[model samples]
Target: MEGPRASGGRAMTGRSGKGHRDENFPVASKLLRPEHRAPIMAFYRFARVADDIADAADLSPSEKLHKLGELRRGLDGDGAPEAVALARTMAERGIDPIHAHELLDAFTQDVTVRRYADWDSLIGYCRLSAMPVGRFVLDVHGEDRATWPLSDALCAALQVINHLQDCAKDYRALDRIYIPADMLAASGAEAEDLALTAATPALRDAIVATAARTRTLLEVSAPFAGGIRDRRLAAEVAIIQRLAESLTARLLTRDPLSERVHHRTVEAVLLAGGAALGQLFARRRR
Candidate 1:
């Protein structure tokens, strides 16, 4: 994990399309432990802002790169509002700045690089974009490397799944493609095939294969549930695992190109509740 330091600045002002400070903090709500919520929210806000800057359609490559550099400087204590807030939250949580920086590197890469030559290159992007975030979460829960590696695999798999789902939007808007070129070529699919109203058999098959690979990674990392000593944290991991399983199932059933598949609000609640209860029951039996 390597990247820029967060500067000690104030919270970012002004709202974009969604005029909410906490919109980007996906998992930060009453659901999490009160003590952990604020810091995690702040971290998500910081990452979201960085991502927006890198991915904004309005900005030119130079502008995006320049802003990212500024963000990097801010992370180093340059005193921008978001940077300042993130720096404080990170310090309070004792989160290593390296993960924050690594994320910046990932966003920077997104702004500059649009295509990956092979699976290895795509995996390398996952290392910067996804693995560090998982490592940071494990660190917050006081987990060690034994758990970190598997957690990272799961996180990277999640990222890959997300990329697969967002392929259409990413290509049409951001001019980015996370699908490996070689894989597409081998399957006789093209980037243009992703924008089709329905997935061709080749494209469908490619996505299914990719989903299977991600599922394998999740399976390898399944034992992570037992490593979390905190009950809440264990529940969180279980919920994530269930979500991954659900996403994989959906990918197998539907063509990702035609319609996006997602867990509905009720479905999400059911899955999370069921997973948490299952974990609690297992612990009680133990």
Candidate 2:
């Protein structure tokens, strides 16, 4: 809740005080090489700043758009400190700013777009919002472009999982809904239902249905880690895949509106360990 404020005393960055450790999946964990971690963290901070701006409750749409534009400009050489840091890292690493640009575009869309019409529409948004992140990471590792398909799937699944996990809070606090309107209609649920303290049967059905679709994405990305050439990055991917699978399963059976769906710290650590081992063995088999 505590963040920078504008002259009017409105919060400028809607930072939830969440860092990489607070994410649903690991970010630039110790598994990564030191060189890779710095640039990745820089990219993450840029993203965090942009996301906070877009989600800032106190900022009007115009103000949010303007702030996002500043970040976009930063990519070009002048902007916010976070954006400048990311640009410096990208320049030093020879990583393209295309992904960062795409992410800014997505955040800009968040300023005005409130609902998705269908699954395809939602996936379209993910293409802008989620896929770029994986692509950016792969670029950081200097991994081949061939790895992007699975990465895209995994990233999108993770984004949707986060959406499902925070559905209630997002709806109640921001009045922004990411679940497809059609999906809600099919389940006899309305967007307003998400505001409830507990999910209704119909709302649960919609959330479960979304989880099922996200499960398919997880399936597609199941081999993501195996496709990566970087051992450390591959291991990280495996951990993320495992986490996504577990969360998707939880979404199917748990109520996001009232339940604790995210993994506890110990659970996440164990899952990461097991996934790392599994990836190691699988790679050795080849």
CA lDDT of each prediction against the hidden true structure: 0.71, 0.85
Encode model 2's per-residue lDDT on 175-259: one tens digit a residue. 7788999989999998888878899999999999999999999999998899899999999999999988999999999998889
Candidate 1 per-residue lDDT over residues 6-110, each given as its tens digit: 111212331233322322112543545777766665666677677777666667778778887877787778845676787777787778888878888998898
Highest-TM-score candidate? 2
How does candidate 1 fare on TM-score? Answer: 0.89
Q: Stretches of candidate 2 above 4 Å error?
A: 1-14
TM-score for each predicted model, relative to the true structure: 0.89, 0.94
Estimate the lDDT of model 1. Answer: 0.71
Off by over 4 Å in 1: 1-26
